[model samples]
Target chain A: MAEKKIKIIVAKPGLDGHDRGAKLLSRIFAEAGMEVVYTGLRQTPEMIVEAALQEDADVVGLSSLSGVHNYFFPKVVELLKAKKLANVLVVGGGIIPLEDIPELKKAGIAEIFGPGTSTEVIVDFIRSNVKAK
Target chain B: MFDVKELEKIKAGKKKWSEGTLAKTLSKAPEKKAKTTWSGIPVETLYTPAENAGLDYESKLGYPGEYPYTRGVQPNMFRGRFWTMRQYAGFGSAKETNARYRYLLGQGQTGLSVAFHLPTQAGYDSDHPLSMGEVGKVGAAIDHIGDMRILFDQIPLDKVTTSMTVNAAATALLGMYLSVAEEQGAKYDQLGGTIQNDVLKEIICRGQYIYPPKPTMRLTVDLIEFCQKYVPRWNSISISGYHIRESGSTAAQEMAFTIADGIAYAEACAARGIPVDSFAPRLSFFFNAFTDVLEEVAKFRAARRVWAKIMKDRFKAKDPRSMMLRYHVQTGGVTLTAQQPLNNIVRVALQTFATALGGHQSLHTNSYDEALCLPTQGAVTVALRTQQIIAEESGACVTVDPLAGSYYIEYLTDKIEAEIEDYIKKIDAMGGTLTAIEQGYIQKEIQNSAYLFQKSIDSGERAYVGVNKYTMEEPPVTDLLRVDMKVGEEKAKELKEWRAKRDNAAWKKSLDKLREVSKTDTNVMPTVIEAVKAGATVGEVCDVWRDVFGQYRPKEFIS
Candidate 1:
């Protein structure tokens, strides 16, 4: 049987209006032939988690340009766990600092892409890391 | 420029060169490299006088400061004075940001460009639950008039011009700004500055738009009218292509689409029975300057010429001041890199040179460390020094429109101007910018262009020196400036104190009056000033408007 297309929800979870990175990643996902559910600017954690469940997404990519990634990114992870969606993979990108990476990854985020990571790297990571439903 | 005899001979020579014995010698060399600006305008191997053919020098390329200002907007340009070197600075609490402003001013920064915190920009109080983890993260956090008071406490409002990058809560911020001036005993006419009251593009590119377009446009126009009536020296709206360029547009798209927004604003003001010349002179523009110096110079010249024609021919403005296109430029922020972060200095320097050559009235150079985090103090000084070096040492400011007669630059200017005008005509055919933005036409264009731009970088079609071509494994950037995490807590605590100390009854009455004014045909500025004086916070006033004019929720773009 042919493999099902990977579905992901790209979310921006704060008051930050800079959406260029989020837009770039969502388009990259679409270009890789994945099903992308883009939750545009100012989405909350509850909304992102609900959308992840509603879309039955294989991945949830959080792009935070505001320095709230330390608080907001892990909150999404916790929301997913409470919602009992253990199969979903959490990832992030943007202006997240270097020191915050370890704790975020430890909080069960699959990976984090920084500024210079190519789209091919993201595509390959999603293809290999996310397990389809 | 070229006589018919010389032109024909050159045309014949070009043809012969391409296919003749000269071609045989050139065949040994590699194929010519194709080039274009980031906006994707096609580039030729070389340009000639044939490119500027049939273009009249007197009418098309008038003298600097003349009508249809294709050369420069001012007669003497930089020789009269250097462009205001304003570096955008703000991060942390009001007290901290005040010090940063003073520091920048002491270091030769002639003006202030305030970058409010994310919650502040979104018109939320720092204590709002939604503001957690984000207060003072991007820029300064100013919740109430108290915070605004601290922000400009010592900086005399009359002496220093400020540009507030505000939109959804422009009225509230301007209210606090005016109140600050009142407390300082400064005359309204003495204050010179800009509140970036361009709401149309905020919906199209930046997602910080609060009220839907109609009311947003109302508030935008209200400020323009209010500024004209009271703050005569203030620029009401800096119609911004800077954010549009940051969001991903070809250089021409940035100019064309921004001018389209300008036309919409002018039409809206005219619809309010305000004559074009009354407010058009105070109208200003803000654009982004990128690393491509020649294209950027051409882009600026083209934009000036386009706006001159639009004001004179389209709007029938009588005053020459109304026809001039005065603008400010900021170096590209999106072009900065994380890897080998120091390379950004070179990028910023080159971009600054372009902004100067483009004859900007003002400029802000992005700090090199911005790609990593908020700029440290060290980085901001270097950024300011870049502008000073270009002005003093580079000899770029010695003359006006030095590249005016270059065949290639002239060709690019004329071509870019025509391309942008074509876009304006198309937008006009679609009814206007409002209709186009509503239909997501402009947003879709930006989205598509952004996608292609990233694809180029990914495919290595674009050479981002530190990103793809000259890749190196580097240690993580740890020396970056990070905002203290205690900012949110401290701000919330202080807000509690501010709420207790202020007279609640008067604040409530002012808010009620603000709501009443919003419902009527009254300009909201006077009421807003009263509200701030009555001790209302930015969020409280914005909440009042939100109740009156519902907050906007754009249609979901992807699923």
Candidate 2:
């Protein structure tokens, strides 16, 4: 039998309308042969967690550009943990400052990608760090 | 513009030179890569009179302030006065933003452009669940008339023109602004500013839309009709291409999509029985000034010519003012990079210069550190000074359409105009922009362009200076503006208190009136102003809209 494909959910949380990066990565992840599900703009943290559970996502990538990552990113992670999704890898990207990255990681984000990061680097990070389902 | 015999002689000379000297040089050095504009229009090795062979000077490139305003809208241009120097700034609480506004005005900035927080832009109060972590982050948090009062505190609304970058809640924001003006004893006729009330681009690129396209358009027309009757000096809608370009569209696509949107607005207004010339004059545009100086200049000129022709030929607008395409430009923010933060200053300077050459009526220069965080006061000051230096010292603004009649600029202007015409034709055939957006055609076109651009940068086909070309090992940037996390809690507490103190009976009556008026075809602007006056929060007014017209849920175009 063929190996199960990596299921990734690219989610946009909060009220940010800048989705050029989010939508671009969604296409890149799919082209990289992963099963990608993009939750459209203005998704609440709860809605994002529910989408992950329903999609059985092995990876949840959060994108926020309006500077709301500090609240929503970790909230999604905590919700996943409450649902016993501790093994699912969660990552974040957007206009996140370097100082805020360590706290986000401490809250269980596997990695945080800043601006000018290449798609190859992000895809490689996901492939290497995602826990097998 | 040249005579037939003169043009023939020049064409022959150019052919001979290209066949001999150009061919020999090409055989030796063999050009680096295919040359094209940012929009992929082919750039020739040399342009001459032949490039503008049958160009009619009168019709194609008319005098400034005339029909087919290819040169400019103002006859004297900057000789009358320099373009208004506006900076988009807001952060933290309303009082904090008010202080920043005062500081900017003190720095000699000519106009004020308000940037609202995402919660306010999306029609949510600071206390709403969706507003967590977002209040006072991107811009000032304005919930009710009280916050709006604090926002414009000492700044006299009558003396200074203010542009509010509000879309989904444009009505509420404009209502609050007008109410604050009333308190300041400013007459309605004296108010001069713009609101980015264009909602089609919100659906296409920005994604801050509240209702479906149909009802959102109704709200847009309602504001236009209201302003036409009462607020004659206010620009009702700033039909925008800036966000579309930031979302990664080519230059031609930006012009085409924006002009198409303008067409849709005029059509909607005409359908509402408002005369075409009545509201068309107040219709202004907002565009992005990218780093490509020549292409941007050409795009601006071509956009003016195209809009003039459309207003005259298609809309049958008779007033000369209705045909003018006055615009405001903001330096491209997507061009900034977090790698080498200071380089963005130079980029903004170049874009500002291009905007000047493009004959923009007003401009905003982005700060260097915006790629990392909100601009610090120091960075924003440098941005404003860059414009001042260019305006006072650069000598680029001394003449009207300084680059007009240049072989290359004229060629590119004609080419871009043709391209815009082609795209607008296609959109019209597809049952107009509204239907095209409903079918996801415009969204997919932009996405494809965005994907191709990223791929080029990733493949090293394009050199992005510090990002793709230059190698840099730099320390992490730490001196960035940080919005206090306590802002959300403070604003929520203030909203609760304000609600408790206000007369509930008046508030309920105002909201009920707004809901009733919104249901029918009556204009909602007067009722919206009354609701805000009665202490209705931004979220409360929008919730009535949400209950009436329903919220928009965009389909994910990416499979």
Candidate 3:
């Protein structure tokens, strides 16, 4: 039998509009043999979680550059946990400061990627951390 | 140009030198990897008079302040006065941003450029759910005229020019600004500044758009017409390519798309029956000064020349000011690195030098620590000092267009101009910029460029100093400016209280008038100003627009 492909949903939550990273990463993820779904700009946390649920995503990657990640990132994690999909890995990126990463991880985000992070590093992180279906 | 015999002699001598001295040098140390500019323009080994044999000095590059202003728009560039040192700043509450403004002005900054928060830019009130985490983050949150008043408190409107970087809701923001100016006892004609009121770029590069192209274009044109009549000194639209470049377009693409956008705006105004010369003079441009010094300088010069021709030949603009392309330059933000944060200071200095050499009307330098978070006071001061050093001490600003006569510079300028013209023709063929954007042509081109840029860095074809090479491990960056998380709740409560205490009946009546005006062919700025004065919030006025013109849902073009 063929190996199950990891389904990843990349979303831009809140009002931030810097989507160059998200768009590029979606393509990179697809090239790495993952099924990638990109939810366009200005998505609410509810909408992001709903995308994850509908796509049966094993991992959700969130991108926010307008500094609203603290509220929106945690809310998505909470909604996913509440929906009993806690095993799914969650990763976030964008101009996120180091001081805020601890709280974000404590809120159930698996990892946080800051600026200058390579696509290979992110792809590797998702491959290793994604939960089994 | 040289005479025919002289050109032939030089060309033959160059061939002989290439076979003799150049061949000898190549035999020992072969030329390094083939070089191309950031825009993919090939760099030659050497340039000589043969390269510019057909150059016409009179038409292509005239004297400063003359037609086809390739040298500059002003006769005495930087000798009369330096470019305005405007730092784009705002965050947290209006009071906080107001204090920052005062601090910058006290530090010898010449102008104020306000950066509104994302929610405010998208026409959302502070209390709205979509605005929950975004209030007062990227910029100050202005819910209504009350916040606008605080934002300019004690800063005399006539003393310092203010450039507000607000779009999508530009009409409401400009209305609030004009209302505040009135409160300051400043006449409309005395006000001087710019509004980055370019909405076409929002649909192409930035994602802060609220309405679709048609209605958004209406709002953009309305502001232009209103400013032409009332605010004569204010630049109505700052057609920008800074965001386009930051989104990873080549320098040639940036120049092409920006001028294309300017063409679209001029066409729109003419379609509205406004005289071309009357409004074209107030149209300004904003560009990004990237790290490629010579290429950026060439891009700016070529853009000026192209705009001058487009105005004089295409639009038949008679006024000399109408043909001039006045612009502001901000150093590239995407060049900053989070790894070796201090290196960004040097990058900013180089970009600043390029802007000064390129002849800009104003400039904004990014803080060294911006790649990590909002700049601290110390970081911002350093950025301002970088500009001051380049202006006062660098000795680069003494001559207007100092690099104008260089063979390489002139050749690059002509080549870049031709490339820009080609792109403009293609866009024109595809039914202009509006249709090109709707068909996702512009966006796809930018995305492909952005992707190629990333791939170059990823594959080590491009060497980013601290990122891909000379690697280092450093401790976490601290003392960066952090916007308080409570800024949202506080501003939301303030908005709720202000809404409750305001004259609700008056506000509703003014909004009704605005709605009625928006439906008709009449200009919407007059009623917008009235609505803000009557205590109508930004979100409320935009809600009327959303109700009438509808919101824009962009079709996802990227896979």
Candidate 4:
């Protein structure tokens, strides 16, 4: 039998229009042989959670360049927990300041990738951390 | 372990090599002879006078401010007046950004560049549920005329040239700008500025596009026609390659793709019974100044030459103004690194110099701390100072087209021009930018380049300073601009009650007109302006357009 592939949902929360980093990450995930579904730019937290649940994703890779993570990611985590999908890995990236990394991690962001992060690191992190239900 | 059979076969084949021949001499030439530069141009072992054989002055490279404008746009560029020193600033409420704009203007900035927040760029009001957390996060939040009024409250509309980096809601923003100017009692003819209203690039590079390509093209044509008739001094659209480059495109791709989009806009205007010469002269471009100094300079030279040729030959543009390619340059934002952030200062300084050498009409240098968070006041000042130091001290602007007549640059320029022409022909084969975008061809090309770049960095072929090579321990960032959390709440509250206060009847009337014109072949600018004057918010105007021209659902790309 074939080994199960990790399912990743790469989404842009809130209204951040910049998507170079998110799109790049999607390609990286796809090339790593993972099933990657890219929720296009400007997706809200509820829409992201809905997509995550429907896609049955094992990892949610959220990228925000708009600096709205303080309001966006926390809501996403709360909704995911309410929906009983807390085990799913939630990775974040973009122009995130180092200071907020701990707060985001506490709020259930499994890993944070800032600018200049290598695609290999993200792919490897997903492969290693995204657990099969 | 050694491949003795292959060695024996090679030795046998080289029978002419006598016993006197050394083992090294018996080996074949190196597999990788030439090096592939960042821009993908292959550098040969040596270049001589023969390389300059076909290229000639007055033909291939005319004088600055002349046809096939390879040298530069103005006859006395910078010598007459230096390029516009514009800084891209916008964040939090319109009032906040307005204060920043006033500060920048006071600091001797020659031009104004507005960077709208994501909600405004996406044609949504700050009160929209989708815009909840994002208001004022990336750039300034502008919901209606009230916000716009605050944006330019103290600034003189007639004196300064403003460039608003907006696309999806460009018509709405432009309408608001006109309304704001009118409210300030300034004549429409006296206003000058640029709207980065290029929608095609939105589909190709950035994903901030609202409507589908057809409606977006219509909007682009509408702006061009309106500018020609009323705001004759304003550039209708800034066909941007900056986002394309920031999205990981090569230098040649940036030039070719942006010019192709420009051609598409010109053609769209022609389809609307607007003459090419009438609207083409008002078209401007926005480009990114990347790390490769010589390559960036060559890219600009080739870009001007290629655009002039396209205007004259493809579109048959008659007026000289129509043939000139004027553009503003911003240093590549992606080049700034968060690690050893101060290094970005040097990167931006070099890139800014490249912009100067490339004959940019205006320039914005990225701040050192931008890779981390929004630039603080001191950081923005340093960013502005970088440009000032270059203009006042570097002496780069003492002459026009300073890099002109250099043998290598000319050769590289010729090569890049040829390569880009080949790309344009390919795009033409795909039925221009619209069809290419619809087919996801441009998106795929950019993604492929991005992937390859990532792979290069992964395999250690490409090195980024302070990232892949130089080791460093970063000091904690002491000064970073943290946005007030209340800004979003304030934006939401302001937009909510402002809607309650507007004249509903007039808003409905103008919106109805906009809806009717949006469905018809009429230029939508006048209708949009009427709507804005009637206090129909940007979100409402966009809703009408959205109702007429349905929202675009991006086609899926399977890697």
Candidate 5:
């Protein structure tokens, strides 16, 4: 029997129009032979979690460049928990400040990639963390 | 054919090499030179007269303001008047942005550039449910003409040239601007400025598009045709390569992709039976000035020369004005570093100098604090002062195309022109820009470049100042602008009250007419103008198009 491919959902939370990093991650993940679904920019917490659940994703990666990540990222984590997606690995990347990293991690974010983070690291991290059910 | 003993001598490092080293280096060195940047432009040890073989005074780099304007667009570029120092500044309510506008004007800013918030950009009112927590976050919030009035309260439109960084809702925004100018007693012919109404780029680089591409293209042509009649002095469309570069495209990609989109628009208008000259002269451009100082200068020069040729040869444009490429440039926001935020001021200054050297008609310097948050008052002022200092203090404005005669600059300029033409041919083969965008060809190329850039930073090949190298444990802090949460409530309340008090009958009539025009092939700008005149808000006009044209579900994916 063949191994099932790990499914992932990449989303952009809030009104951030900067999706260069997010879209690049999706392409790298797909190139690495993972199943990736990207919800384009301006995704709300509800929309992100809903898409993650619908796709049956093992990991949820959110990108926010609008500086509202502290307010928006935690909501997605909380919504995922409420919707029984607590097992899903929640990840994020953007212009997240250094001080906010720990709080975000404590809220169940698997990792955070900042501006200069490589696509390979993001792809490898998702691949390593996300396990097939 | 070459001497093998000499090549072996150079390869073994047995002798000091100079002139004869070229042939020996080619033979003995690695077959492929490792490329640092994309777009296939090689980094040489140093370029000399030999590298500039084909470049001549008369043919390659003509005098500024002449045919094949590789040097510049005007003979007196920056000597007579410096580039318009237009700072991108706006946030909070219209009242607050208006105050900032007055302050910037007082600081000697020649042009006003409006940066609307997410709600306005996406064609939603501040009161819309989707606009929660985002109202006035990125930039100023404007829902209707009432807000527009306050946004430009005391500023005279006829005197100062305004540039609105708008698309998708460009027609609606331009409609509001016209109404305001009319109220201020500024004649349409007397008004001047630019609206970045290039929707094709919205699909390529920026994702702030409201409707699908077909309807969006229709709306874009509508603005071009409408501006030709009413706002004769206004630039109907500024096809932007700025966002494309900000999205991590190379300079050549920016040049090729932008001009390809412009070509598509020109062809679109021609299809509509509008004379190409009527719209081509009003077509301006917006570009990003990156830190590759010499390469950036060369790219701008190459862009002008290439665009002039295309207008003359392909479009058969007779008027010299139609072929002139007038543009505004903004320093690349991606180049700014948040770790050592203050260092960004120096980076922006270098990039701004490159833009001025490139002969941009207008320029905007990004604030240092932008990497962390929306710019505070002091940060934006510093950015503006950067441009002012260069214009007044530096001798850069003393002559036109000061870097024009440099052997290396001319070679780089021609090289960029050739590379961009190659990409343009590839895009054209894929059925022009619209089809290429739909097929994700351009988007894929940008993503590849972005990925490689990140990989380089991660691998220590590329050294970004406070990131990857020059390690900093704690980033120095700076004050960042935080929009007051009250702004959302206040704007929502204002819109609610305005909706209740406005004349409903006339609004509906105008909206219905606008909708009817949108459904057909009729020019919708006139309908939009009438609707705006009758108090039909921007949201209402956008909603009508949203219904008729339907919303754009992005077909391309990152995968």
Candidate 6:
């Protein structure tokens, strides 16, 4: 039986222009036989959510490096919920402090990967946490 | 190099030593790691003069302070004076950043580098919807001359050298800065500072570009022209490879792409009928001093040699200063690890050694807490003190080109230079950097290198200390600095008040004049200065330019 490939939308939100992580992840996801939609730099929360819904992504990784992660990450989650994207798994990374992880996960982020996280862990997390429904 | 007889003797001795000594050691314990560096350049067990046999020392590496400067740019180098310690800083409001600048200056920081918030860098007002959550996060928020004045208030502009980390809106920022200097009663000719006005790299890696390549190149060239005439002491454009490296380019790619961009800028200015010698002297470069100590040292030396040849032989520049490649180095930001946070301090210290040994004219060391948040005052102080300790305690300042005449260093220097030249040749054949970028050649190359680098790290081919090996459990870092969200609202309120109180008639007249200059071959600085002095906001002035020169949409590349 053929299974559906995992589709992920990697978007860099807010005004921070550091896209090394997002671009690398997008490439790695594609190389891992998944569909990756990359929203270029300076994407607003609304734009990110729109892209996620339009791409029919099972996982949306929001990368925010600026210290505004607390404001931007939650807004993305809220917008995702408002759009009835409850089935999509949301992940956050890039300069988010360890203390903020619990609150972010509570706010509907499925996983929060801090720096030095191996790509294998992220890949496995996506494979398991992303709902196949 | 050794004489023929001595070379023969040394070669015979080396062959015997490798067979007996190296074979015995390898038999006991084979090499575990791959024989390559992080950049994928192969490494030899040992380098010797045999590897540097064909190197033309006199032509490739002339005297220190001579053309084709490979050893050092200046005659005495660090023996005469230490490199300027420029700390890159900015966060919160203008008033807050102003205080930080003064504090750094008081602690013996020699230069000021301003990091603008995202909105400012992207040419948006603090109140713009696109800037809602990002007004003053990464850097300070400056809306107009009012904030610019506050940012430099009480600090003597002429006595202190400043560097603004701006690109898209650099024209307005430079205008605001010059107005500040005028208000300080200092002549424009005596101002010492740098504005990172190079937009080509923004289009390539950084996403702060405001206009298409043609108009953006015009703006970059206009600054070069205007600074050559008025702001004689200022570096108009800092040709940047730092961001390219931060985007995961190899050291050779960093050198070649940066030099290629400089070539494009020079060619643009030439097409505008400006003499090369008129502006080339003020042209400075910004580079990344990564953790590869020997590679970095060789890269710096190779850059000077390459740029000198480009100016003298290619551009036919007559001035000696035009051929001299002066540069500022910043330690790599991406190399810092969030795990085992204290391990970063050692990484930074070692990287700082690379910058000092690479003969950087100025340097900025990354703070330890940057991998977590904006560096706090204590972290920034430690960052600055790292440079200071290297200058005072370390034996770095005692000699010039201290690592000269090393077998490995010379060999690597030659190798990196050849590879960089190869890339430059490829770029040149494709009709220079702008054409190459538009065709997605450079970006794809960089993206491929980045992917290879990431794969190597993931596959354990390249080992990061606390990341893949030496694992440990540590708690979250709590002492990191956080910018209060009130900075954005406060700045918006201040901008509203400033606009409401300003003379609307004069502001419009100045902006109208700015709009007029945007459509012609006339210089943009005078009108930009007039508009900024007339209370035009940063966004307002940039909006005028945006109306005339269309905004740039980046080209996408997949590798």
Best by DockQ: 6
Clashes of 5: 0
Runs in model 3 deviating more than 4 A are: none
TM-score of chain A of each: 0.96, 0.97, 0.97, 0.96, 0.93, 0.96
Interface C-alpha RMSD, model 2: 1.2
C-alpha lDDT (0 to 100) for residue B283 of candidate 2: 99
The regions of model 2 sitting more than 4 angstroms off are none
Colliding pairs, model 4 = none
Interface Cα RMSD in Å, per prediction: 2.0, 1.2, 1.0, 1.6, 2.2, 1.1
List TM-scores for all candidates, in order: 0.98, 0.99, 0.98, 0.94, 0.92, 0.98
Collision pairs in model 6: none
Per-residue CA lDDT of model 4 for B1-559, tens digit only, reads: 1155654555554453433353445365443344666866787544433455567677888899999889888998889988889999999988889999999999999899998888889998877887787788788988888889999998989899999999988999999999999888899999999999899998886888899888888887788788899999999899999999888889999998898898888888888898888898899999999888989999999999999999999899999889999999999998899999989999999999888889889999999999899888888899899999999899899998888777778888998999889989999998888888888887788777877887777776778888878858776576679888788788877777887888899988989888888888888998898898878877889999889999987875534
Q: lDDT tens string, model 3, B463-551?
A: 88899988798888988788888998899889889999999899999999988989999999999999999999999999999999999
Clashing pairs in 5: none
Tens-digit per-residue lDDT, B1-559, candidate 1? 6688988888877777668866687678755556877677888766777777866788878888899888788999999899999888789999999999998888888999998998877888998877888899988999888889899979999999999999888988998998898889999999999889898888887878889899989999999999999999999999999989998888888999999999999999999989998999999999998888899999999999999999999999999989899998999988888788899999999998888888889999998888778899999999999999999988889998888888888988988899899989889999999998888888878777888888888888888898989788878878788888899999999989988999999989999999999999999989999988888988898899889999998874421
lDDT of 6 by residue, B42-85 (tens): 98898777777766778877688988888788988888889999
Report every candidate's CA lDDT: 0.88, 0.93, 0.92, 0.86, 0.84, 0.88
- Say which prediction, candidate 3 or candidate 6, comes out ahead on lDDT: 3
Every model's DockQ: 0.65, 0.77, 0.76, 0.67, 0.48, 0.77
In candidate 6, which residue ranges exceed 4 Å CA deviation?
A: none
Candidate 5 TM-score over all chains jointly: 0.92
Of 1 and 2, which scores higher on lDDT?
2
Badly placed stretches (over 4 Å) of model 5 are A1-6, A30-34, A98-111, A118-133, B1-40, B476-478
Q: Is the docking of candidate 2 incorrect, acceptable, medium or high quality?
A: medium
lDDT of 1 at A94: 89
